[model samples]
Structure formats: structure tokens, C-alpha cells
Target chain A: MRHTLRETWTGLRRNLTMTIAVIVTMWVSLSLFGAALLANQQVDLVKGKWYDKIEVSVFLCVPNVEGGQCTSGDGATQAQKDNIRKVLEANPQVQEVYYESKHEAYEEYQRVYRDSPVKDVLTESTIQDSFRVKLSDPQQYLGVVEQAKSLPGVQAVLDLHPVLDPLFMWLNALKWGTLGMSVLLLVAAALQIGNTIRMAAFSRRRELGIMRLVGASNAYILTPFLLESLVAGLIGGLLASGTLALGVYFIIIRKAATSITTIMWIGWHQAFLAMAAVLVVSILLSVLPAFAATRRYLKV
Target chain B: MITFDNVTKIYEGQAKPALRGVNVDIDKGEFVFLVGQSGSGKSTFIRLILREYRPTKGIIYVAGKDLSTLHSWKVPALRRQIGTVFQDFRLLPGKTVYENVAFALQVIGRPTREIKKVVPETLDLVGLSGKGKRMPDELSGGEQQRVAVARAFVNRPKILIADEPTGNLDPATSVGIMKLLDRINRTGTTVIMATHDSTIVDQMRRRVIELDAGAVVRDQREGVYGTA
Candidate 1:
């Protein structure tokens, strides 16, 4: 064991440049891999938090409403609003219906658009009353929407899917894009590791030949090379884990979590999982290539 | 002991065989010389005994184990009982003479205590006791070859195969190496050497096997370098 370790150190030191190249490549690729995993987790969290709260807003006609639905030109009466609510409640797809008054709508608009100039242009009378209908299955919103749109006082029905689809699509693209890039880099790292092992084996061919002549087993001859790659991979994995922890702490926890409280961000627990995955992937990347390269280059 | 029964070897992508069908038997503690021109199958014969190459036909038995039926994993175990030396005196350039010799025992998993005792003794036996700390580059060609010899004999293998061990040395230096092998063979270790050094072969008067075009042309009990 001592001889093997000593030989491993000798090999690493002799091929110091190649060893560093392997480690750096592994570190960057493994970090990207961990980031891709965390991005996927973040996308799932955003989807879970927002999908549960999606509701269809059925806006009733207001005074002097223009365009298509509000042709009556006068505000919807209480009886007209009650008739729309009844229709929505009768739909099996609609889980619950709540009437939002014009005053409540105006207050929500003010709260949401507090820093926008549009908030100053809207008043309580200008806001339309609406029935916020929650569906048993959010994917079945179209059925409830068509029923509410044909109701007596309904001006228009809005299904939040249109607003949320693009956001989810962008999130998904970011996740998959990160994952694709990580896979490419992982391949690059593996190739670099293979090249490094080949060079090390070439430089030590004399020692390997002598060892073989002395009756060294294949495993005995190969242990030092394997150990060299293992050490580099372990260091790269540790660095990647550190990078992942720092990224999660700074980008998600400190920045996104603090700014966007509505969505749950991945915590250290999930980061740890991603970090563990990075370590396993990095080790596999280094060790497998080294094994293959040695088998080809080191005949013993 | 070694036996070759109808052994023939043809390398891949080659039309001609390196060794033709031939049979020979060597008893224990024998010192035999294999003499042939280049490509006459001297190296091939030694490689077969080391299990480095499998015969394309027939069988070779070394130390009572059949080379054709030997498992690939068991080749190393078979090699541990045999020591090999090359024409180039294959020694680790960076290691001292002592470390180079110790490496042989170390790879075979010999205990450090035994290695400590055996390495110096073997170095002394090969006339390199006080020069253990010298590197290969610092030594003469003959001294480097002696270091190679010490490493090959450190494990005290049952058989020693030297493929032109003195191919790079002066006649005087070659004589010193021959004396060392002679001393080793007297201790009951079989020594088989393949060489083109006619002077050394003539001086030794040992069993000689001569090959021509991968076929054994002559076998003599006590022979000179050529027919006389």
C-alpha cells in the first residue's frame, strides 16, 4: 500500500500539468451538473407553488364598458352577478367560486401594481367585479371558462394558463439548457482524464515493464494509475460541492428567496443532494476513463 | 524444469511462424544457452517460458504447469517463479540501485523486513553492495546490467531467463555477468540465456540449442559457439 501510494504521488507529480487539467475540467463540469440539478428542483418548486393557486377570473360588465362583452353600457346589477355565480357553481369542473367586489379588485390592483404608473389610473368604479373560480383540476379550466363566458353579466373570462405557460416554458428551457451544457462538459472532462492517464502511462512505461518482469500483477501495476485519477477526481468533486453550496447560498437563498417570497426555493438539503450527485458523477468521470486508458496503454 | 512439446508460434498478421514445431526438455539446475541469429526465435522461446505469449500450436510446460492451459490471471503467479532480464537492462531511471532491486521484491508483496534483509544481500551477491545509492545514469553499462541482474534474482526465482543481458556490455563486463549467472546456477536455480555473443558461449562450454528459421538445427550436450 505504501509503495502504491508513493508511486501514485510520483505519477501525479510527474504529470502535474495533465493532472491539473483533469481536475479543473472535472470541477467546472461537475459544478455545471450540480447547478443543472438545482435548476430542475427550482422549476419544480415554482410550478408547485403557483399551480396550486391558479384560478380563472370571470369579470362582470361595468358602466360604460367598451368593446365586445359589455354591450349593455351599464354596470351589472346584483341579480346579474348572482346569476353568473350560480352558473359557475353549477359546473362540475369548478371547485369553488368567490365573488370579488369592484372595491376588492381595485385594492388588489393597487397592492400588486403599487410601484407602477397604471395603479394611479385605476379607481374602484373603474374596476370590474369578478367571480374567482377555482377548478378541481387546473388543466380542466377551459370547461369552466366557456360556461362563465356565456353567463348573463360576464364580460370576459381569463384562464391564467396563458399567463403562466410562457413563464413555465422559460423555466423549463433554462433547466434543460443547463443540463445539456453540463453533459457536454462532462464528456470533455472524461476525455481529458483519458488523455492524462495515457500520458502518465507512457511516461512510466519503463517502470511498468520492470514491474511486469518482476511478476507484478495487473492490479498491482494499475493501482497507482487508478489512485492518481481517484485523487484528482476527489479533489474536483470537493471543489464542485463547495461551488454548489456557495451558489445556492448566494443566488437562491440570499437573492431569489429574499426577493421572491411567494415561491419556495431549494434549501441546503437539496443543495446537499445535488452536491452528492456531483461527487459521484465526478468520480465516475475520472475513474472510468482512467481505467479504460490504462487498459489500452498499460499492457500489464 | 521446462518442456516444449511441438511448440509453434505465429504472430498475428504474419505469414511465417516465429517458432516451428519443436520439442525440447530441460531439467532443474541446468544452465542452457540459446544461440541464433536475429529473428531465429530465440526471443520467442524465452517469451513462451515467461507466458508473455501463447503458442499458436502445441504446449509448453514450465515448473510442471502447462503454459497453454494456464489461466490469464495465473500468468503473474507463474512469472513470480521466473525472473526475466532484457538486452536494454530495463531499470527505473529515477530509482537508485537499491530501490530498483527492492522494487522487484516489493511488487511480489514481500514483507519490508525481509526486503530489507534480502536486497542488500542480493546486491552484494551481484557485486553492487556499496553502490546501492547510485542511479542508473551514474553507472556504467555493465553496472546497470548488474543492477538488472540483482533485481531479477532478488526474489530467488526457480528459473532466470536472460535475453541478451550482456548485449550492451564489453567482453570483460559480459564475462563478469556470466560468472554471476554461473554462481547463481550452482545454487540450483535454472538459468537460460539467449545470446549472439559467440566468445562467451565458447568460453562457457554449456548445453547449447541452435535455431535456424524458427526450427532447431542443432542441440549439443557440451558445445562451442559453432561446429568445430
Candidate 2:
């Protein structure tokens, strides 16, 4: 162990530029994964913050129907509308339902487009009434949806769960994509490490040969070099984690959070842990290359 | 003690063997020079001892281990008993002379205190005592070769394999390196050196194994470097 360390320290000292290059490469690889992690975390934070207030919009039918959603009992009958109102008011999941009559609907449409020319093309006679439902929480929509589907008077039900659905879906894709990119960068770092070790071993071929002749074990020959690689990788991981944490804290959390204070704040502890995880991963990936390069290219 | 019994080596895609029916015995504490021109079996002999290349048709024994069956796992163990120095020196360009010598001990997982004593002492033996911190490039060819020699002998190996130790040095420097090898031999370590340097061979008057076309044609005590 003492021998291995002395060798590792001396190897590191001798190969300064190569050591720096390895560290930089590892840092960049880890940082890419870290950024993607932050992005996914942000998306998760947004979804968690907003999912509690998911709403459902239930459109009501006209007295004599004209928007072409009236075929095959498709539009709500009077009985169906009455049943929906009862369900919304009594269901444990429902917080409240504000019924929009045709008049109220027309007024909202006008209010929304008061300055637009499109408002002149529509009147209250042509507008449809609807029930605007807000749930106690978004997750309750599953139970509420099952009940709403069987209700009579509802013409259509639109749950706000679909809004947060895209958030999770996109987050999933981004996390995996970032993971793939990190793997590619890790491969690049390994190859670079291999090349550097090869050159190093090649240059010291005589020393290695001599050592072998003297009955020095292979373990003695490779241990120091392996340790050298581990040291380089660890240092690189630390640098990468540091850089990523700083970027997340300043760029994503503090600066972006300033404009999005209504959303959520990412704490320092979680960020620190994430970077630490990245460091561990980078260090693990580097060991094999150190072994392979020395064994194959630098073999005496 | 080592023996090469009718050993032959055929590399892939080569029609002819690198070594053919080569047979010889090198006893313990003996100093022998393997002499041949380039492309002769000089390198093949050294490699066989190191187990870098195994014999194709015969058994070669080093320290009682049949090298033909030596596995990768057993390699390091085998290497610990023999020290080899190559013609090119093969010094780590980034390392100082001290570190270069220390690396030999370090790789085997030696203790720090042991390496501390061993490294500097080895350097001093090679006449680089005060030049320990200088990098490989900072040293001359003779000094670099000496470092390689010191590394080979640091473990107190049973055998020292020097394949053209003075290949890159001047005549005087070559004499200095040869004398160093002689001193090492006097300490009871068997030495096997491969060289084409006729001047050194003639001067040493040691046992010389002359190779021609991958086969030994002459083995003599107090022999001169014979023609290929």
C-alpha cells in the first residue's frame, strides 16, 4: 500500500499536463449530466407545486343545440346536466363548481376579446354554457374522472391533470437524454486516459522490463498506475461537481428563481448531494481504462 | 538457474520462427552476453526469460517455473525475481531520476519507509545520488541507462536481463555501464546481456553466447563476441 501510494504520487507529479487534461475531461462529462439533472428537478418542482390545484372544465349543452356536438345523444340532456351539478357539489374530491350560463359565457368571451375584431362575429345566442370545476387536489382527478364519465348532463369533461402530464413526460425524456450524453463523455474520458497511460508506460518500458526481470510481481507494476488514474478521476469529479453546483446555484436557482419566485426554490443541500453523486460516478468510470491501457499498451 | 530446451517462437503471419531449436543453460551467479546482429535471436532470448513471448515447441524454465504455462495472474510474481533493462532506457519522461528509480519498488506495493531508503540508495549506487530530482530529459544517455540499471537491481533480483544497455551511449559511457553490470554480477546476481557492441564484448572477456539465424552457434567462457 505504501509503495502504491508513493508511485501514485510520483506518477501524478510527473504527468502534470496529462493529469490536468484528465481532470478537465471528467469535469465536463459530469457537468453535462448535472445540468440535465437540474433541469429535470426544476420540471419536477413545477409539477409538484401546481398539481394540487388541477381543475376540470365541463361544457353544458344548449337548450336546442347548434354547435354540431348534438348527434347520437352526444350533447347533454337536461337530466344529464342536472346529474352533473349534483355530482360536482357532493363528491369529496370537488372543492367547488361555478356554473357559467350562456350569458355569463358570452360576457367572459367578450371580456377576453374586448379589443379584438373577432368579438363582433359572436353573440350570446351562439355561446355555450359550462361548469368550471376546481378540485381539492390534482391527484383526486382520478376518482373524480371515473365519476364524471358516468354523469348524465355533462357534454365534455377536461381535466387539468393533462397540463402537468406534459411536465413529467418532458422531464423524463430530458433526464434520459442527459444521461446518455454523460455516458458518451465518460467514454471519451476513458479513451483519453488510456492514451495517456499508454504513452507513459511506453516511455518507461525499460524500467518495467527491468522490474519484471527482477521478479517484481505484476501487482507491484500496475498498482501505482491504477492509483494514479483513481486520483485523477476523483479530482476531476470534484471539479465538475463544484462547477455544476455553482452554475445551478447562481444561474438556475438564484437568477431564474428571482423571476419565478411564485414557483419554488431549490435548496442547497439537495444540490450538494446531486453533485456529490456525480463525483462518485465519474471516479468509478475511470478505473477500468487505467488498468486496460497499462496492461495492453504499456506491457513490457 | 535457467534453461532453454529446443525453444522456437513463431509470431503470427511470419513464415519463419524467430527462434529455432535454440538450446542453452545459464547457471546461477553467471554473467553471459548474447551477441548477434539485428534480426538475430538476441531479443527473443531476453523475451523468453521475461516470459513476454513463450516458446512454441519447447520448455523454458526460470527459477523452477515452466514459463510456457505461466498465466497472466502469475506474471507479476514471475517478474519479481528477474530484472530486465532495455536498449532504449524507457524512462518516464515526466519523472525525475529519483521517482524513476523509486517506481520499481513502488509498483510492487512496497512500504513508504522501505521505498524511502531503497530509492535513494539505489540511485547512489548508479552514481546519480545528488541528481535524484532531475527529470529524464535533464539527464544524459549514460545517466538514464544507469537509472534503468539501478531500477533493475533495486529488488535484489536473482537475474538481471540487459538487452543492449549501452546501445545509445558513447564508447566510454558504454565501458562505465559495463563496469556497473560487472559490479552487480559480483554481488551474486546472474546477468544476461544481449548486445552487438564488439568493443565492450572484446574488452569484458566474459562468457558469450553468439547467435546466428535464431540458433546458438557458440557458447564459451571468457569468449569474445563472435561474428554473426
Candidate 3:
């Protein structure tokens, strides 16, 4: 074992430039993999936060108004409003119900749009009252929307899904894009590792011939090359995971988390999982190629 | 210690065989020379004994193991019983003389203490006791070949195969190497050397087997390099 380690060190040092190339390639590939994992986790975090907070807004008519949605052409009466609330509350999927009156709607609009000129034109008479229903399973909003559409006072049953779907869709595409790029880089990294080991073995063919002549076993001859590749992969993976963790801490936690406090950010638990994944991938990338190349090229 | 029985070796895609119907035997503690010109199948004979290549026909027995039937994994154990030296003195240039000699023992899993004890002794046997720290390039051609010999004999192999061991040395250096091989042979190790060095062959007065066109043309006891 001591000799194997010593030989591995000598082999690595003998080809310092190739060793550095393998390590740097491995690092870039593994870090990309780690970044993809973290991005997916972040996407899932945002999806869960935003999806749970989504409310199906059921708008009612305005009273004593022309061209209103109700049959009376004024607005929905207090009786119709109570009936709609009863229907929403009785549904098994509705987790919570919030009723916003016309006056309250106008106030919220004015406060939220205070910086916009549209706030000057909005009034209590123009604003519509609504029932905000939170579902037990946010994905099952179709059932609630269908039930609310038949109610007497409902002007229109609006679901927040369409507004948020496109945003989440783009985020999911970004996550997969990174993951796809990482797969390509992983292949490049595997080939790079195989080439490096092959070169190491080729350069030492003379020594290998002597070792074989002196009764060295195939494993004895191949171990040093295998160890060199494994060591390079391990170091690269460690650096990649470290960089990933630092990137998450600095970019996600420090910057994104503060700017988007309403969305939940992935934590250390996800980072650890990403690191483990990167480590396993890096091991396979290094060991499989090194093992196969030694078997093929280092016939001794 | 070594026997070849009607062995014939024909490489792939070749019309001519490298060796044909050859039979020879060397007893334990005997020194034999395989003298031939280039392409005379001397290397093929040595390779057959080492099990580097299996004979196309017939069988070879070394230390009572059949070469034709030896498992590939067991090849190393077979080679462990026989030490081989090349004309090029194939030593790792990055290692010092001590490391080069100790490597033979290291590869065979000898303990460090045993290696430390035996390597210097083997170097002394090759007349290189104090030169263990020198690198291969720093040494003369004769000294490099001595290091190779030391590495070969460090394991105390029963058979030592030297294929043109002094092919690259001058006449004087070649004679010095021949004397070293003679001294090693006197210690009861069977030495099988393949060389075309007529002067070394004549002076050694050892058993010589001459080959021509992939066939043994003559076998003479206490022979010179010329035809019997």
C-alpha cells in the first residue's frame, strides 16, 4: 500500500499539467452538477411557497350599478353573497375563506398601487367585492372554480394558476437547462479523466515492463494509476461541493433570499444532498474510466 | 529446471513460424547460452519459457508447471520464479539505484525491513554497494546493467533469463558483465543468456545452444560461439 501510494504520487507529479487539467475539468463538471441540483431545489422551494399561498378569487357584482353582472343589473345582494360563501365553506377542498368587501378592496388597491397613477381613478363603487378561497390541495383548484361558477352572485371565478403557471414554467425550464448542460460536461469530464489516465499509463510503459518482469501482479501495476485518478477526482469533487455551498450561501441566501423574502429558499439540508450527489458522480466518473483504461491500456 | 517439448510458435498473419519443433532441457544450477543471429528465435524461446506467449503447438514445463495450461492470473507467479533482464536495462529513470533494486522486492510484497536488508546485499553482489543513491542516467552503461542484474537477482529467482544483457556495452564493459553473470551462475542459479557476443561466448566455456532459421542447429557442451 505504501509503495502504491508513493508510485501514485510520483505518477501524478510526473504529469503535473495533465493532472491539473483533469482536476480542473472534474471541478467544473461537478460544480455544474451541484449548481443544477441547487437550482432544482430552489425551484421546488419557490413552487411550494407560491403554490400554497395561491388563492382562487371569486368576484361578486357591484350593487346599484348599471351593467353589473347580477340579474338585477345593480349588483349581488347580501343574500347572494352569503349563499356563495356557504357554498365555498362547505367544499371539502377549501382550507380557508376570506371575504373582502368593496370598500376593503378599494382600500387595498389604493395602498398596493399607491405609486401608480391608476390609483387616482379607482373608487369603492368601481371596485368589486370577492371571496378568496384557499384550497387543501392547491392543484385541485378546478373543482372549486367549477363550483363557484354556478353561484348566484359570482361575477367571475378567477384562479391565480394562469398568472403563476408561466413563471414557474420558465423556472422549471431553467432548472432542466442547467441539468442538461451538466450531463454534457460530465461526459467531457469522463473522457478527460480516461485520457489523462491513458497518458499516464503510456508514459510509464517502460517501468511497467520492468515491474511485470519482476513478478508484479496486474493489480499491483494498475493500482497506482487508479489511485492517481481517484485522488484527482476526490479533490475536484470536494472543491466543487465547497464552491456550491459558498455559491448558495452568498448568492441565494445573502442576495436572493433578501430580495424575495416572501419565497422560501433552500437551506443547508439541500446543499448537503447536492454535495453527496456530486461526490458520487465524481467517483464514478473517475473510477470507471481509470479502471477500464488500465484494463485495456496497461496490459501489464 | 526448464524443458521445451516439440514447441512451435507461429504468430498471427505470418507465413513463417518463429520457432519450429524445438526441444531442449536445462537442469537445475546449470548455465546455458542461446547463441543466434537476429530473428533466429532466441527471443521467442525466452518468451516461451517466461510464458509471455504460448506455443502454437506442443508444451513447455518450467519448475514443473505446463506453460500451455497456466492460468493468465498465475502468469505473475510463474514469472516470479524467473527473473529477466533486457538489452535496454529497463529501469525506472525517476528512481535511484536503491529504489530500482528494491522495487523488485516491493512489487512482490516484501516487507520494507527485508527489502532494506536484501537490496544492499544484492547491489554488493553486483559490485554496486555504495552506488545505490545514483540515478540511472548518472551511471555508466555497465553500472546501469549492473543495477538491472541486481534488481533481477534480488528476489533470488531460480532462473535468470538475460536477453542480450551486454548488447549495448563496449567490449570491456561487456566482459565485465559476462564475468558478473558467470559469478551469479556459480552461486547455483540457472542462467539462460541469449547473446551473439562471440568473444564472451568463447571465454565463458559454458553450454551453448545455437539456433538458425528458427531451429536449433547445434547443441555443444563447453562450446565456443562458432558451429560445433
Q: Pick the candidate with the highest DockQ.
A: 3
Question: For candidate 3, what's the TM-score of chain A, rounded to 2 decimals?
Answer: 0.66
lDDT of 2 by residue, B1-228 (tens): 999998988877998888999889999999998998788888888888888887788999998898988786787778878887888887777778888778777667677799899888888887888998898898889999999898888888898999989889999999999999999999999999998898888889999998888888899999897652
RMSD of each: 8.9, 12.1, 9.8
Q: What is the C-alpha lDDT of each candidate?
A: 0.86, 0.79, 0.86
Candidate 1 lDDT over A230-256, as tens digits, reads 999889899999999999899987898
Worst 10 residues of 2 chain A by lDDT: A65-74
Predictions' DockQ, in order:
0.55, 0.30, 0.56
**Cα lDDT for residue A21, candidate 2:** 90
Tens digits of per-residue lDDT, candidate 2, A1-300, equal 655677688888888899889888888888888767776666655554224444777776555553334444345666767778888889988988777777887876665444334666767866767777778886667777667755655556667567656756776787888778888988989998898788778766766665665556767778778888899999888888888878877876669657864445454645776787887787777788888887786564
Docking level of model 2: acceptable
- Displacement of residue B185 (Cα, Å) in model 2 is 4.4
lDDT at residue A250 of model 2 (Cα atoms):
89
Candidate ordering by DockQ (highest first)? 3, 1, 2
Candidate 3 CAPRI assessment class: medium
Q: After superposition, how far is residue A153 of candidate 1 from its true place, in Å?
A: 21
lDDT of 1 at A67: 41
